[model samples]
Every structure is written in structure tokens, then in C-alpha cells.
Target: MLRQCTRPIPRWRTVSNVLYARCRTTAPCQPISPVSARTGWVGCLYSTAAASQSQPTTDGHIEILGRLHPTDSATNVSPTIVSKTTRRLHLQRNHPINILKRRIESHFRDYAVMDSMDPVVTVHQNFDSLLFTPDHPGRAATDTYYVNTNTVLRTHTSAHQSDVLKTRKADGYLLTADVYRRDEIDVSHYPVFHQMEGIRTFDKKKIEEEAKVDSETSAIQGAVLSESNPIQPAHTTREAQLVDLHLRHSLEGMVRDLFREEKDLQIRWIEAYFPFTSPSWEMEVFYRGNWLELLGCGVMQQEILDKSGNSDRIGWAFGLGLERIAMVMFDIPDIRLFWSTDDRFISQFSSGQIVKFQPFSKYPACYKDISFWCSETFHDNDFAEVVRDVAGDLAENVELIDQFQHPKTKRTSRCFRINYRSMDRTFTNEEVDRIQDQVRQVTKERLGVELR
Candidate 1:
């Protein structure tokens, strides 16, 4: 019988429940299956729950399991954005998005499906707690959505890592939520997208002993992992090596299990960097003739462990984009389709279903060009956020059709072509006209662009 360390992970908890981690080990060393590793989804990938800025002004809080109080700056977090097409996509039943999420989560059913948190979080939870340096780009207003100088819309589900780690609720968990980022306009880039964070910490000595036992699989697991993932200088060689083996082996099993249906799947690992972890690596899969990065992970930094009240534990964490994987798995051509509210889009998929998304009759895209004299501080991401805020999912593609510099004034002029289209139905000129007008007016006021 094959023997691998089967660590007993804790039950999942909701946001209202106290979060903490406590783990144990099992003796079974049965041959690993693609799904033998325990996994569960904590919540939705895209949250309908991020604190809203334009939520019909209450106490500036939306009454959720936890009240989402307004901070200072907000985007896409407003009730209008939350109530949009995203609410149609979730991890619950009858939703295709959740159906895909559950495929992985089913492997770890005992774990709690933790609900999402208020996107507005303290700067410490978002950055400092993760050991990000003061000058980190993520801390910049240009890259992250801030609720205030001291609070922000979480850029990743990992923003909750410190808090949950401190609670000691479960040694392993999967947190899924809508994360915000300032991004360039593209078919794939949305200011608000979904992400899931998976992390598991282990007792320092148990893992080392598990490795020392020299079990048949231990040597092979150890050798293979050591050849690739290295130990941190700060960690004891033996402990580091054992933890590394567990981390890589566990992740490999997860990837294989995730794509078990594919007979010709390709996967690889490459060294990478992250502020929170040492000896980091990014997992990539060969898909559609290109290598797409699936996730980023590494051994958990000791300081993070110390803060989480697990000073004596050694562990690992990985974060993945749900849309990235789901898109590939379901043969979805457009990132925006996942947010489709059309009955045509929703009717095809069902609860616990795994079906390739079938495309409906396509509508032609109407393009509108807006030329402007731009400010020195003009950012493409800032411009895209405006388009998203004004047009929501109807804004299909935002491309810079042309750009030039006026030599006499030393000013940059830009022309952007906005492709407006409806996935479910054809757009009338009158309908597109109103939206186009709104876009132009909003860009002028919000982006400080002088319409040319």
C-alpha cells in the first residue's frame, strides 16, 4: 500500500464563525488519487457582497452576515455593480460557475464553504500583514481600489489570510471572493474578478518525522521535490525538505485531479517570487498552444506563521484565478460570458453540472471612437475602470485605436475605440447611443480628458 502523510484538516467555517486552524494526521498511506487531497470552497469567486460605495446611503453599511461598512474610496463595490450580472454567478446550486467550483470542492467536502468578506478592509490586512514593503505597487491607489487611505477593496482573497490564520479555525481552507485590481482594458481584464486562496499549515516536527520514516513514497516524493523546489535558508534543512515535498506533491495531485478528464494535459512548475513566501513557484499548464499560469504558491513565510499563532508550524499557500481555469475547462471564449445574465446563457448549465458553454447567435459589435487630450497622469487602467463603472458588462472591448503627441504643446492625444455589444440580444442604435453618450460624459468628468 502506498503511504503518504494524510494530515487531518479542520472543518470549514463561515465568516460569522470564529476562524482558526488545528490539524492532525492519519495513518492511511493509500495510493494517492487525483482527489485524495481534502479540499473545499469557502465562498463565491465573485462576491455580490463587497461593501458598496453607491449603495443607497444607509449607515454606509450593507447588512450582511457581517455589516459591510463604507470606508472612503470605492469602485465596482457599489450595489449597482454587485447587483449586476455577477450576482447570477456564484458557488451555490443552479449556477455554472459554482458547479465548476464544486468539482474541486467536492474533494474536500468536510471543510466549510466560508462566505466572502467585506471588500473594504484595513490596509494592514490587505498589505502590511502580508509583509508587503511600504512602497509595494499593490499599495498604490493607481493599482488597488481603496475605500479610504486606511482601507481598501481586497486585491486578493489572501487579504483575509492573516485574520483566518490567527483564529486557528482550520489548518486548511479555501477562500473565494471578488478581488479588485487596476488593470488595462482587454477581453480578459476586469477591475473586479474572482479568486480563491488555498492554504494549509503543518506542525513542524510531525512533517519532518513523516519524511524521516523513509516510507517507500517518501524517498521518491522527497527526491523529486528537492530537485525542483528548494529549501529556505531560514528553515532547518530536514523540516524544509519535508514540507516542500508535501506542498509540491499535494499541489501536483490537485492539478492532475482537476484535469483528470483531459487525456493530453500538460503541466509544469517554474520558480517565482512573492513577498509573503520563500522558494515560490508558479504553476503553468500548456493550453491552446500557449502556457497559461494557473497559480502562484510557496512555503509560507515564518513571520506569517508567527502572526497567525502558528509560530511552530511550517506550511504553504497558493492562490488561483477561478475565471482563468474555468474558462479553459468549459471552452469559454470570453471572460465576460461568465457574467452573462441572459436566460440563454443561464439555461444551458445546471447544478452540479459540467458542460462546455454553448455559444448563442452572436450580435455585431458597434464601435465608437472618443478622442481626447490626455493628462500626464492619464492611466489606461483608470480609463478602463470608468468604462466598467459606466457601462458594466455591456462594455465588451476597449482598445486604443490610435494615439499621438502634439509637439507644440507637449501633450498626448489618445483615441479609444469602445466596442459595445450584447451577448444575449442585438443592440439598437438608439440603445447604443445612450450608453455611448454616458461613456463620453463620464470619461470627460472622471478621467480629466478634454474631448477632442
Candidate 2:
């Protein structure tokens, strides 16, 4: 979701884990910017193109998490994403995201919970620490929101994995935080979302000792191990099998617990890949006659553990988006509603509860299409970002309705349809047309594409 504009800084009050920003005077308080309401620090909003061109402060730097950061061409962190830095939706008491977080915490009661990590992190921490290759597409400017050449809005909670593992303070831990990504405009896709990373380490010697007491500890059950997802070369087959079994069993059990109320919930695991984890597998659950991927897990890469001074420990790690599960469990049809301040939305949820979301009346949608010749550097996410920056949450969806390539010039012409609608009220045709015009102007100027 995206938003803009600034209002008077206000005092905050928390009720049932929802932060409300209250104005100091009798003047009506605007909607609380989630992070500002919780942290008592606010930032002025800027459009993506404006933010890219102008620094937030006179010093040619931007204020993020109460610190100044130098900006350059690499600075792509928009004010919309900046505002989400401190939202901490997972920490909100009655929010569905938090409810899911607490439910998982209940299943892993002994795991240490870490939820307050800063969203801004060094590129090394966000990518290199997790073993992402230098040329990986995720590192591209179009996909990531870079604070500068060296920092970024952490794309995943896993960015903190290496640092957290270094402490070696907890045998198991659960880290939850808001994660940012440049994405499409759709009901399920949003630029800012939340994730929870869970890790559990086991001392090989202890596992070996326990295996003698209980043979089942070393057995891999109901899982087919293939060459494609083999144990790492550095790990003993027995230890790897043990850890893999523990990982799958733990996750399957947690899923069952989360969906215990549903009748006959079915889950299956499939082989997967990730730069940081070897022999990875993704868990998916059958829901509404479709398969919904729930999370990804694998035996921790040996190098990661070795780097953390735990060469002797073998472990399993998994990460899941709280929003994905919450949406499915709560029947939330639109992702933007999660960020809404509407009483109708908030009143239906409570801490420790799993209730289906009842959507309020939806306003009509206004459609506008823009056709343009593709530029060499154009990316779909760039177009989406422009629409988000210009239209904010009012832009419900953007779809590529038509595309064609000119045979002689070898140039591509594409058209996108933007669905404009207000969550609270109807939009006049003039208002939507005006917004669409801004989108066209921005697209041409920022993207360097020719209007068709």
C-alpha cells in the first residue's frame, strides 16, 4: 500500500495493539501513519520521482529512523515505504498479522522472539550476508529500494539472520519485521509486507547422543530425498537427515496447529532452492480448492553456521509472510485493508482470535489506459512505482492489457489499464482522469518512454 502528505505531529495512544495518533489540539486528527503513531516521529511525504530527485533535508540527506543518510542516484526509498519502517504491524496486539505471529510463537513457545529490528540495513547485510550473488536480479535498482549505494530497506527478515546467529544466545529464535519490495498493483501484492523468520540450531554432539536414546530422532519420515535436494557435502548423512526431519516435522506440526479448526486441512512439501539454504523445500496447504504456498524451510547452510561461530551446530530455518497466511486464514480479499484505519476493519479482529474478515462496501472502479513505446531501461516495476506514487492506495490494480512489437524498428508498444477506486468513497470521472494524466506525465518524464 502507498500514501502521501503530512499532517501535524500528534501524540499516540495504543488500544488493543492498534496505535492511534491523536492531535494535540481539538483539530480533527488525520489517519495515523502507522510508524509515526508508534514511534512519535513523523516524516513529510514525497512522491517517488520527487524523492528520487530531491533530498528530504537541506543537507542533501534523508532522515530515516531518526538518523541522516546521504543520498545519491541509488537512493530509491520512497516516503511511502519510509513510513512503513516503524509500523510494526506484527507487534500490534489485535491485528491479524500479530495474531498469526502470536499463534506461531505459541507453537514454538521456547523460541526467542525478536520483533523490533530496524528496517534499514547495509547492502551487505541484506544481500551478501545471505549469500546473494552480485548479479542477482533482486539487487537491481528496479526491484530494491536502496537508501544509498550501501544501504536499503531490508527486503526480508532473513537479512538479520547472520547477525542474530552470531549472538548464539538462543537455541531457537523467531524474528518478525516489515519487509519491502517493489511489486505490482494487485489485491494480493503490496510493496510493504511483514515476515517472520524462524531458526532452530542443534548441537551435533547432543543430537548424536539423543539419537541413541530415541532412534526416531535420526529417521526421515514421509519425505522423499532426491539428488536434486540432497544433503550438503559437509554434513554427515545421519545429522542432515535428522535436521531435515526435525525441520519438516516442526513446520507441518505448526501448520496443523494454525489451521486446527478447519476440517481436514491438507499440506504437502516440494523441493525448492534458495541461495542461503541447500536442499530447501516449500510447504503448501490446500485452501479454497487451490494450493497456497505457506513457507520455505531447509537445513541451514553449513557456511552460514560456520560464519556465526557455530561450526559444531546443525540447524533448520524457515521464513513465512504473515500477511499471506493472515489473508487466507482471515479471508481478507484486499491487501490494503490490512493497513486501513477504518473502525469497521479494526473492530472485527482481536488478539488471540482467528475470525474471517468481513469486507465493507467497495466503491466503483475507474479504469484508465496508457500506451507507450518501451525504453531500453524500462521495467514493469518502475511503471508500477510511478502509479503507486501518483495514485497511492486509490490505485487498486494495474494490468498490462495489450502489447506489440514493431517489426521494422524492433520496438515494443505496451498499454496498461489502471483501476482507480477509493476505499471510502466514489471517485468522480474528472478526478480519475486528472490522476491518470499525472501518471502519463510522470511515466514519460521519469521512465523516458514515448507516449503512444
Best by lDDT: 2
Name the TM-score of candidate 1.
0.79
Task: List the candidate 2 regions with Cα displacement exceeding 4 Å.
Answer: 1-58, 209-223
Find the number of clashing residue pairs for candidate 1: 16
What TM-score do all the candidates reach, one by one? 0.79, 0.86
lDDT (0 to 1) per candidate = 0.60, 0.71
- Whole-model lDDT, model 2: 0.71
How does residue 215 of candidate 1 score in lDDT? 43
Residue-by-residue lDDT tens digits, candidate 2, 1-452: 11112111110011100101112221222222211111111112235355344224456687878988888878877666676676777888898889989999999998999999988899998878777788776688876788889999877777788899999999999988887777677665677777778898988889765323233652236446688887888888888777777788788778889988967887777676666666777666776666655666778888888987899888888887676677668877777778877778889999999998887898899999999999667888889888777777887789999999899998999999999777777889997887788788878887889998
lDDT of 1 by residue, 1-452 (tens): 00111211111101100011112222321112111111111112112122213323455543322355454435324443334323524554665557756766776564455545666678898878888788765566666666556776666677788888887777687777766555544455455556666777777768755434334543224523453455666688767666666666766667767877766777676555566766666565665556545666778788888987888778877776666566667666666666655667668778766688788888898888888999899877667766666666677788898999998998999999988776666888887777777777777876779998
Superposed model 1: Cα runs more than 4 Å off = 1-88, 109-112, 209-230
